[model samples]
Target: MAQIAFILLCHKDPEAIISQARQLTAAGDYMAIHFDARANPADFQRIQDALNDNPNVTFAKKRIKCGWGEWSLVQASLNAVEAALDAFPRATHFYMLSGDCMAIKSAEYAHALLDGEDVDYIESFDFFESDWIKTGFKEERLIYRHYLNERKHKKLFYASFRLQERLGLKRDIPSDIQVMIGSQWWCLRRRTVEWVMDFCRERKDVMRFFRSTWIPDETFFQTIVRHVVPDTEICTSTLTFLMFTDYGMPVTFYNDHYDLLLSQDFLFARKISPEATELKQRLGELYAAKGIEFQISNEGRSLFRFLTSRGRNGVRFAPRFWEAESSLGRERELLIVVAKKWHVAKRLASKIQEVTNIQAIEYLFDEASCPMPDLGGIQTQMGKRARHRRALMRMLYEYYDTDRMVICMDPKNMEMFQDFFTDRSITRLLEVESVFTDDYLAGHAIRVGLAGENTPSQSMERLLPTIRADVLGESDRIRDAGFERYYRISELRDAQDNAFALSQFLTIPQDEALQIAQTNHLFDD
Candidate 1:
C-alpha cells in the first residue's frame, strides 16, 4: 500500500493548522506535525487537544525554536520526520510541507502519483551553474560560513559577511559533494527518508558545516538526496506550488487567489496567511467532501516548467552587488490604459508617454505580441489568458527596471491593474469611452477582412455590452474610493482638463501637455 506521512511544520494559527490536519488525514493518511517552540504554548495545546483523539496524527516531541534562515528549521523538520516514522511505520512516503500550506488534492491522489516510484521528489541544481536564486549570495552561501541569523540580526549579520568578504575568508564545502541548492519542499520514499536520517547520524562533520551556513534547510535534504540517490530516481520538481518575487519573497495567497491556485497542477500551496480566513475555510470544505478528485494536467505542469526556468528573467536581473530597498512594485507608479479597442488604447498610451514620465507599453494583452521590457517579447496564449496575464503582471511589478510604467489593456482583458492594487503606490485607471472609429475599424480590417463599417465581428458585438457596463459603472465607484488615477478621455476632452489629468505624472507642465494634446487632436477619437 502507498501511504503518505504529511510532515507539516507549523508555527501560528492553531485553528487553521487544525483544519488542515483534519482535512488531510480524513482518508487514513498519516501526519506528523512539528510546532515551533516559539509559538504560543496555549495554541499548541489547543492543536494537541483537537488532534489528540485522531490515531492518524502525531506531534513531534523535539520542538525547536525555529527562526528564519537558521539551523533550527532543519532540526525541527528532522524531528518531525522521526516522529512520523515512529508513529506511522506503515507509511511508505513522507511529504515536507510548510505551516501555511493547504493540501489542494485528496491524500489518495499522492499515493496514486507515487504508486511504484522509488524517487526523491525535490528540486536540486548546481548552485554556481544555476541562475534560479534571484537575490542572494549564490556561491558565497557555501564558500563562506555564517553564524548570525540574517532575519533576526540583519545589521550584524551583513556586517560580519562584509568583514569576511574583506578578509577573503573561504570555507570548504565538505569534500567531493557538489554544492546544490533548491526549494525546501520535498517528498521522499520511506527508504530514502530512512537513508537521510542515517546519513544525519553518521555524517556529523558535514552536519556541523551546514549549521554555520545560511538557510541550509533549503539545500540540506535536496543536496543530500542528489548524492545518496541515483540520478534516475531524482525528480527536480516539487509537489507543492509557491512563487517568489525578484527580491526572494514568497507571494502570499488571499481569498481572490485561491481559485487561481486550484487551477494549477500542484498538490499543495503555501504562504496562505493566517489572516486569510475565507481562503482557508473554503479549501477545507472543498477537500473534505467525498469523491472529489483533483487531477493534475499536462498543461498546468508545462506552465510550471516555464515559470521555474531560467527564461523567466533568471538571476540575470538581480546582480549580487545591488541590494533591494523593497520589491519593485512598492516604489513604482503604474497607469493602466483601459479601452475596448486596441488602436485606441495604443494611441492613449503614446500620448501618456509623450507627456508623462512613464514607460508606456502599446498593447499589454493582444493577439500578436506584448513586448516586455527585458523579456524580448511575449506571445499571448489566449487559452489560459487569465493566468497568463496575471503571471506577466506579477513579473512586471516585481522585476521591470523602472520607477513607472503605463500598461495599455482593453476592458475585455483588463487583467493586471486590479490584481496589484496594494503593491503599487500610484495605481491609475484611464478608461476611454471606447467609441468605435475608422482607425479601430482599420486595425480590425487587417484581421476580419471586412468592408466599410462591418460592425465588429459577432464575438466583439457580444462582448461590447459587458465592456460598456463595466466601464460606465466603475467610474463613480473608483472616484468615491479616492483613486486619483481615475482618468477618462471624454472628461479630459469635454472639460479641457487634459492638463489637469496629465499634471500628476507630467514630464512636461500641464499647459504644455494641454497644448500638445490640442495641437495633435490627441483626445479626439
Candidate 2:
C-alpha cells in the first residue's frame, strides 16, 4: 500500500477535525494537523486528547495565525506539509485538507485510487482566463494591495491604494512565474511536494510577492505546479465537493443534501458546520450503511441535543408551513391575489369572485398588505421580496392540500381575469407576482404550473409537459410578435393606456386587444 500523508489546516470545528483525523488514520497513512494559532486553547487541547493514542496522527509545532485572503494560510499549509514529510519519510502522496472537510471515501479506496493514477489532482485555471476575474473586481485583487488584517487603518490604506491606482503605480508579478488560481484543497505526489518546497526556498522574491497579494493560498501552489509540472501530469480536479451560495459564501450541507452527497464521486466534502448536526448524523448513518464506521464527538452530540431541545420547545424555531397540514378543507379553493395595493387586490378579488364564483385570498405587495396567519414573529433573513414570496407560497401550500392547477397573475393586471378564467377553473388560480420585472411573469407561471403536480398522491409527469408547452408557446408568441418588452405589465402601465395598447404595439386582433384591456384596467382607474 502507498503511504499517504494528509496535511490538514484546521481552524474552527475541532470535533469535526478530530473525527476526520480518526477517519484518515490507518497503517500506512499519516495525518499531520496545523490548528490555527487563533483557535481556542481548549478546543485545540480537545483535539490533541482525542487523537493522542493514534501514532499515525501528529501536529505542526509552529502554528500560524491564518486569516482569509491572507498569506498566513499558505504559511500554515507549508508548516503542516513540512511536519508531515519529516514524520513520514516513506509517504508517497500528500493530501491537503481543512477542518470543515471530511472524507467521503475510505482511506484504502483513496490509496488505491492514487496508486493507480500518476498525475496530481489539483484544480487550476489561468488567472486571466477565469470568468470570476473578468466579472468580479479584477484590479482590487490583482493590481491593488489589500491589507486584509490592518483593520484600524483600512480606510487610509484603501485611500492610498486608490491614489496609487489613479497615479498608475502598480506592482508587477515576477516574469518567470505565470499566475494561476484554483481551489486551495489539493492532492500531490511526494516529488511534487519536495519540488514546491525547494522552489519556495530558492525564490524568496516569489514568496514575498505573494505575501502582499490577496488569497495567496489559492494561487501560490497552482502557479508553482503549472510552471514546474507538465499539463499531462496534472489532473484538473481537487476531488473535494464544496458548495457555495450565490453571494459566494460556502453553503453548509444539511439533511436535504444527503442524496446529492451520495450521488457524487468525490473523496471528501467541506463546510459541515456545527449547525449541521442533523447532516452529520445523517452522514454517520449513511457511512454505516456502506459498512464504514463513522463517529461524532461529545461536543457535537451536546450541541445537537441543545438545538433539538430548543426546536421542540419552539424557541428560535420556525416551522415550514409549506410542509404542514392545511387547515382549509378540500371544499374551499384558494384564490391568491398578487397586487401592490390593498384596494386593487380587494377590487380584483371581488371582481374575480363575481365572474367565477370562487372564494379567493388577496396577497398585497405594498403598504396595505395583510399578514398570513400562523407566521407571526417568524423572520427569514432573506431579501424582502424572496421572504414575502416564500411566505406566500408556504401559506398557499398549507391551505390547499390538492395538487390542482393554479393561475398566478397580478391584481394590477386584473383585466386578464376575464381571459384567464374563461378557460381555467376559478379554484386553480394562485394570484402572485414578482416584484422583479425580469422574472415577474415566468417565475409565477412556472410556480402555478408545478403546484399540484407534486402532491402526495399524484404521479402525473404529463402535466409538466403540458404546462411547459403552454408557457413556452406563450413566450414564443410574445417574442415573435415583439411583445417580450411588454411582458412586465407594471413598466408598461406608465407608458400605455391599458393592455389593449399592447395590441396596438403588436398589431394583434381585437379580441386579444380586449383581453389586454381588461387586465390593464386597474392602472386605468
Candidate 3:
C-alpha cells in the first residue's frame, strides 16, 4: 500500500492547519507545510512548534511572500516537497492541499484504494482545447511573461499586461514539451513526484519560463507530468473535492455542510472555512477513527457538481433542452404531482410524501423563483420554463439518491410538456383532487377557467379516481381503453396502498416502503 504524504500550502489559520496536520500524520504518514511569508510570525511559529514533537511533520525551508497567479506559490511548494523527501523516506505519494482543507475520508482508506494502483491522480488537459482558463489571457498566459503581482498591485499588473499586449511581447515555450493546465490539487506517486522534481531542477531554461508564467502553480506540474509520465499512468482527476461557484470561486463549507461534505467520494475536501469549527471537529473524529469503511462513488461527485451548478441566476447550463433535463435528472425515476392550479399542487405536494412515503417535491416549474427570460423572445421564455421544470425533476432524482422521485406540477405544465410525462420509461404520474378546507381559499385564487362560479375544486367529502386515457399498442389497436398510467391521492389513503405504489415504482418491498412512509408521517397529517 502507498503511504500518503501531504503538502499543505497555507497563508492563514495556523490553528486549523496544526489540527489537520496532526490528524493527517497520526498514522505515521508525513506532512510538509509551507506558510506564507506575510502570515503572522507567531502563527507560523505556533504551527511549527505544535507539530515539532511529531517526527513526521516538517515545515518548508523558507517562507515566500506569495501572490495570486504568481510563481512564489510553486517555489514554496518545492521547498516543502524537498523537506518531505528528506524527512519521510517511506512516503509513496505526495498530495497537494490548502490551509482550509480537511480529511473527509481516513488516510487508511486512501492507502487501501491506492494499494495496487500505480496511477497518478493529477488533472491535466490540453491548454487551448480544454478551455479551462476562464476570464484571463487564453493561450498567451503561458507563453507571455508575467512579473507583476495581480492581487497585490492590480493597476500595475493590468498596466503591464496591457503594455505587453501593445508591444506584442511573448515568450517562447520549448517545442518538445506540450503545455497543459489543471487544478492545483494533485496526488502524484513517489516516482512521478521525483521525476517531476528532477525535471523541474534540470530544465533550467524551461523552469525560468515557468517562473514568469501566470499561475505557474496550476500549469507547471501539469505540463511536467504530461511530458514525463505516460498517459496511461496519469488519471486526469484530483483526489480533493473542491467545489466552485459559476464564477470559479471556491465554495466555503459551513457547519451544516458536515454530513454532505463527508458523504462525498473524495479523500479530501479543500477550502473548509476556518469558522466551521464543528465541521472540522466532526471530520477529525471521523478521520481519527480506524477501520471505517466507505463506499467509493462517482455519483456523489456528479450529484454535487449538479447541485452546486445552481446560483442566483438559475441552474447554470448550456441553453439546450436535452442538456438541461439530462444534466439535472440523470436516470432517476420521477413522481410528478399534476394539477390545474399551482397552489393546489404545491399544497398537496408537501403532504404526498408524508401520507404515502412518496418523494413528493415542490413545483418543478417555479415561475416566481426563476428569473424572467431576456427581453423580446417568447420562445426563450417558454423554452426556459420547460427546461427548468424537467431539470428540477432530474435534479431531485439524483439528489435523493433514488431512481424515482415525486413532484407537484401544474396540468398546464403537463400539457406543455407532453413529451416529458409521456415518457413511460422514467415517469410515474400522480394527481391531487382534494385540498384541506383551510387551503381551499388558497387554490381558489389560482383558478383555471372552469365551472361558471369556479367554486372550490373539491370538498371534504369528495374523492375522485385518477384521470384516464386510452392507450394503444401495435397496429394502432387500443390495448386498453380508458386506461390511465397514474396513481391517485385517494387510492393511497392507507399504508398498504401507499406501500404498494412506492414499492412497485421504487422497487423496494411494500412493508419497508410503508415503514419509510410511516416514519415520514405520510398519513399522520
Candidate 4:
C-alpha cells in the first residue's frame, strides 16, 4: 500500500485541528499541519504537545498568512506538499486539505483510489464560479455572466476590455496551457506534486493570476493542469456539512440535513465540526455494532459513522415541534428568522408585519436561566433565549394554524430550525419563500403574472447594459477565459425561447398572468 500524507492548513482552531490529527492517526494516515500566522504560541504548543506524543505527526516551522485572492494560499499549499515529500519520503501520494475539512470515506477506500490513479486529482474550477464580478476589477462587474450557459471565456474577457488598462496585466496565449481539476482536497502522486511546483515557477502570468484574482485557490491549479497535464481527473466538490448551516456557533445547537450529508457521493467531507461530538459518538457506536470499523485521521479521531439509511429506526431522535404536526388544534403558521440578537429579530419582525401584514407575538428567553427538558418533565429555567425560541416555535405550530399567521426570516435562521423539522412535505407547514436572493422567486413571479409581462426581456435588457459596463472596465487576470465565452456565446440561444423569456420583457404566460392579477388585484390590460 502507498503511504499517504494528509496535511491540514490550520488557523486558530487548534483544538479542532488537534482533534482531527488524532482522528487521522486512528485511520493509519500520517499527519502534518501548517498553523496560520495569527495562531498564538501557547495555542500552537497545545496542539504540538498533543501531537508530540505521536511519532508520525510533523508540525511546520513557519506559518502562512493566506490572502483570499493572492499567492499566499497557493504558496502555503506548496509548502505543505514540499514538507510532506521530505518528511515521509516513502509516501507515494499527498492529500492537501484545510483544517475545516473532514474525511467521509474510510481510509482504505481513499488510499485505494489514490494508489490506482497514478495521476493527480483536482476538482474542476470554471472562471464564472470564481469571484470575478464581486472582486475582480473595481468597475467591471459581470453578474449575469454566471447564469449564461453558453458564454465563452474569450467573450467575457473581451467584455471586460478595460481590465487590461486598469491592472496593467496582459494575457498572452502560450503554446502550452493545461486545464484539470478533481478534488480541491486531492490525492497527488509525488511526481505530480513536483511537476506542479515546477510548472508554477515557470509560469509568470499564472503566478500573477494567483496574486491578483479574488480566489485563486481552484483556478491556479486548474488552469495550469489543463495547460500541461495529459490526463487529469476532476475529483470532488467543496460544499460539505459546514456550508449547509452557520455551524460552530458559541451558544445554540443547530440540526443539519444529516441524511443528505451522508448521501454525498464524495469520499471525503469538508468542514466537519467538533461541536457535533454527541452525534459523532452515536454514529460510531452504530457502526461498531454493525461490525464496520469507521476510521479517521489524527484530527478527526472522534468522528462517528453509522449505516446511512437506518437513522429513523435506530435512534429515537425528537423532531422539532414546528417541523412536526401540532397535536393541539393550534398550529401556528409562524416564520421565525434567526439573527445575532433580539433587536435584529424585532426589526425583522416589524418588516414582515409591514410587508405581509402579519404581527408576530414576540417573546424573550435568556440563555443563562433556561430550563432544559428532564426525563419526565422539563426542568424550568426561567430565561434562556434558545428555550424561548423553542417555546415560540412550538406555540406557532400548536396554537396558530391560520392563513395570515405566518413566520418569515432570513435563510440563516431557518437553518437553525432544521433540527425541529423532519417532515419535508409541503402541506405540513407554511414555507414563506424569501423574495430576496431567490432567483426561483423571480422566475415564478413571471410565470404566475405577479411580475410585469415582458419581464424576461426587460431583465435581459437590464442585464446586458451591466455586462457591457463590466467588460469595458476590468482586468484580464481572471480565473480563465471560459466564463467570458460561456456568457457571451451561450445566452443568445436561451434568449430565443418564449418559455424562457422573463416576465419584465414580454407578455406573461396566460395561466401565470391570471394568478398574478388575482393575487395583487391588478386588472388585465
Best by lDDT: 1
- Among all windows of ten consecutive residues in candidate 4, which has the lowest summed lDDT? 483-492
lDDT of 4: 0.46
- Report the error of model 3 at residue 94, Å: 0.6
Q: Which parts of model 3 have CA positions greater than 4 angstroms off?
A: 295-525
Clashes per candidate (backbone, < 3 Å): 0, 5, 12, 96
TM per candidate: 0.59, 0.56, 0.63, 0.45
Q: Model 3 scores what on Cα lDDT? A: 0.67
lDDT of 4 by residue, 1-525 (tens): 866788677777777777677766665667778877666879888888888888668866567875444456666777777777677777776777777566555566556656665566665544444432333342221111121111235475444554555665454433344322223456666776778778878877656544544334555666665555564353433322223222323122222423333334445555555677654443333321323333221211111211121133223346556535532223323233332223434443454454445545432232333223331232244333343445444444444444333332322223233433322311122122111223433443333333333333434344334333332222121113222111110112332331222122112354442232223211111
Report the C-alpha lDDT of model 1 over 397-491, residue by residue, as the tens digit. 55655767788765543223444454435677766654544454444433432212322244234334543444444444444545455766552
lDDT of 2 by residue, 293-409 (tens): 322111222222323332232123343464233223344333444443344445545544444444444433332244334444332322342334434444555555442212234
Instruction: Tell me how candidate 2 scores on lDDT.
Output: 0.60
lDDT of 3 at 70: 93
Decoy 2 TM-score against native: 0.56
Which stretch of 10 consecutive residues in model 3 shows the poorest summed lDDT?
A: 466-475
Best by TM-score, which number? 3
Clashing pairs in 2: 336-431, 403-452, 415-518, 415-519, 416-519
Give the total clashing residue pairs for model 1. 0
